[model samples]
Target: MPTIRLKTTINAPQERVFNLSRSLDLHIASAAKTKEKVISVKQTGLLELNEEVTWRAKHLGVYQNLTSKITQFNFPHSFTDEMQKGAFKSFSHQHLFEKISEEKTQLIDVFEYESPMGILGKLADKLFLKSYMKRFLLERNQVIKTTAESENYKKYIST
Candidate 1:
């Protein structure tokens, strides 16, 4: 399996940025090309370790439903989600946030996904999936970064 890690810095407070970064609704909103559904959310212990969420979304014009459980969480610093079921052979996305200044946070996203169909998968990964997938994730993150830094987003999160 191949892992690609990307990092970006966003100008926002730790608490504010973390809250927005971890929001499922906000994530969906940032992706104009894709739609998502939340199958469930634990009313209590949200943003806490062990919290689980079930959701489905469209990517590359394909719908993939998944149940992901929060494997790790520390109030806002870092967290990980492991997919229970999805289109990929395996999937996981880990988000890390570090306060660099009073109004800035370093955001790191790490992802691991496996393609199906062995030989075809190998071919796709090498031939096309690699660069294309990286761009897809980075563009999504850019959207998140842009939205999170907006004045409206700040006001909404503050309220």
Candidate 2:
């Protein structure tokens, strides 16, 4: 499995950052370039622990559908989601939020994924998939950071 660790500092509260990270609306907006959409029934809005969601999107010019489940959750501190079905052999993404101050929060993402095709997958990972996934996560986190720091976050979270 290949691991990707990233940290993003947002000028917002930890609660805001955490909520935005799990917001269905925000995710759809952030992945607008890929046209990612939630296709699972009875799964929308803020995702909770043990909840599963299926997403359909276009990646690498190929259309794919992936199903994931929230395996762990701990309020505004941390959460973990793992792939149940997808192109990859397996994947797990952990979201961690640290409160730096009343107005600052650091969002950390730890992503690990394994590709199929054995040796061919390893070569692809080494050659391009690793960097590609990193770029994808960075873009997603940028959207989270920007949205969490702005007043627009209110549209995703409720009081």
Candidate 3:
């Protein structure tokens, strides 16, 4: 599996930042472009352990549907999700939140994915997905940072 890790320090507390991370709505709103691609996503079950979310999106020039269930959720700290379908041999994303200070928090996104083919997979990864994934993570992080700093979210949350 090829792992991509992006760590960012956000100007917010661990709890507030963690809540924002759990808000799928905030995530979609932050990433302006990807918001358009996604048709809809909803959490029908309890959002704790093993909760499932149906994600519908158009990517790679096609309509891609993926179901992800919460594998782990430690409130105001961390969570993990495993992909049920739609591209990649295995996809698991871990989100970590750490209180660096009374107001500052560190947000880390660790993504691990494996391509299907053997040798060709490596080539595709190096040529395409790896860099693209890095950029994607960075952009999403930027959105998160902005949203976290916004007045609406910044009000009750310490940052």
lDDT of each: 0.74, 0.93, 0.74
Poorly placed runs, candidate 2 (over 4 Å) = none
Give me the overall lDDT of model 2: 0.93
Lowest lDDT 10-mer window, candidate 3?
37-46
Clash numbers, per candidate? 0, 0, 0
Across 1-159, the per-residue lDDT of candidate 1 in tens digits comes to 868799989887777667776666666666556677676754222355676777677866788777777787876688888877776687788888989998898888898888888989878889887777788778877866787778766533653
Task: Give per-residue lDDT, candidate 3, residue 91.
Answer: 91
Candidate with more favorable, higher TM-score: 1 or 3: 3
Over 1-159, each residue of candidate 3 has an lDDT whose tens digit, in order, gives 899998999997677778777666655565455443333345321256786666665555566676777899998789998887767788999999988997789999999998878889889899997898788789878877877766666542333
Query: On a 0 to 1 TM-score scale, where does candidate 3 land against the true structure?
Result: 0.84
Q: Relative to the unseen true structure, what is the Cα RMSD of model 2?
A: 0.9
Please give the ranking of all candidate structures by TM-score, highest first, separated by commas: 2, 3, 1
Question: For model 1, what is the error of residue 110's alpha carbon versus the real structure, in angstroms, after optimal superposition?
Answer: 1.2
* TM-score per candidate, chains pooled: 0.83, 0.97, 0.84
Order by lDDT, highest first: 2, 3, 1
